[model samples]
Target: MTGPVVVGVDGSSACMAAAWWAAREAVDRHAPLHLVHSWTSQPLDVPISQDAHSERLYGREVLRRTEAELLHRHGDLAVTTDLVAAPAAQALLARGGDAELLVLGSRGHGSVAGFLLGSTALRVVGLTRCPAVVVRADDPTVGAGRDRLVAADRDEVVVGVPEPGPAAEALLEFAFATADAHGDLLRAVTVVPGSPGPRAEEERRAWLAAELAPWREKYPKVTVAERVAVGPAAQLLLTSCGRSRLLIVGRRPHPSHLVWKLGPVAHAAVRHAACPVAVVPHG
Candidate 1:
């Protein structure tokens, strides 16, 4: 069994939505749910007596009440809570490495430029060893049967292919697992990193064909379809999101160090995808 599903909750409306989202995922995966909250020990710039330690204590109480309320409301779910001693962002990043999925609520806490580029979401997006799902307070709907590449039949699972790396296994595993569960086809998609050179591209396609053979045969319920295109990963993914019920992606490495930064394509898709996206780590 996997570790608990993690969600950052602060009692806000957006946080509530994030909790609901995480809860649904936890139920689907048959995993425990972990609701986390954090606060700093520093005092406010104003002449405030509330130090960071006091604030954390208050935060802990709030978390306790919140968890109790959640458990009561979702009696059927197995819910747990954690009150940690770090800022929300840092604590989330630290815990993200162990959880199956990390989710956050967007309260417009970052800059306008950052929001346009999805910056605040990018912070943990790159660093997390698991996929992080960010839900906007204003977002009214969540999508399902959403695929980046979906088959025509109803019983097909859609898998997303971000830049292949440590997390490639997540997409492959999710696709097959879903197929195995529902007796559906498994669709895989990869955004061509720019238009490929003809010969080089052909070689990659051959490689992909070879890679798929074992999977298709092993999971006979998993029929396969592939999509390759160029432009941006996020945009392509968003397009794919329109077609499939679920999208699978790799966990972002770290935001600051990578050239492409936080896997913008994955970021855009997760924030805006029509279907629920599972950002799984390769492990």
Candidate 2:
């Protein structure tokens, strides 16, 4: 929780947008902003003459340009840059182990494209030890001329509360902490399958309230809104993203030996959500 906010940059427009988002987040959390650019040699089949050297040089330039832009926007913010010789996901996971939050960019054109066919961004989010946020290059909330303070006050933080147990505590904790920091409203939502009767809806509401009780007490200043709906979890959550500044979802930890995959809801969120999506790993 005390480490700097780390973001991966690959000299793409999407990564640059994510870097900007990470800069504002770092400032809000009073943490340093670390820019990581990872590059590796060309494949064995391809000609390797001077390719590795050129890639390294390009990586450094990308980091330098990103660092300068962030510092220009946030004059007093502490910023650092790193050029690593590794795959993007590997480099990010290594640096993000001690970070408070890991931010990455998604180049997917739409939900159908879905993280551009599950590339580095998806891999990093699935395996990251710390919370990971996936931001799109075209996200409306992140750009020049958008006042950070005003946006914080106007937008809400939407969190998907799937169940009431220790597993959900981490998700709720992040949501409440974020809303508290920004002085924004926290919208906690849970979805039930198909249509339910009044009694079922009431029970679901009670469950959601119980899950959020401790967090509400912990962050009394943060306003809370509970929403229980009947439909697909991913669908409902995606709809909520339109009015939200940040969407938080939970990812159950998977074994290291197994192929990493995000849950349906979290997968949809990171890939399709209109706003920035934070995938927090929980037990």
| lDDT of every predicted structure (CA atoms) | 0.60, 0.79
Q: Lowest-scoring 10 consecutive residues by lDDT in candidate 1?
A: 108-117
1-283 per-residue lDDT for model 1 (tens digits):
7877788765565565567667656766777899887655221221334577766676677577767755655578888777877666677778887787787665433311111124544666666766666655443343221221223433445666655444565567666765565555567766556557777566656655666677677777667887666666667666765445556666544434333254555555566665555655454
For candidate 2, the 10 contiguous residues with the lowest summed lDDT are 111-120
RMSD of each: 6.4, 3.6
Instruction: Please report the TM-score between candidate 1 and the true structure.
Output: 0.68
Which candidate has the highest lDDT of all? 2
Prediction 2 TM-score vs. true = 0.89
TM-score of each: 0.68, 0.89
- Candidate 1 CA-lDDT value: 0.60
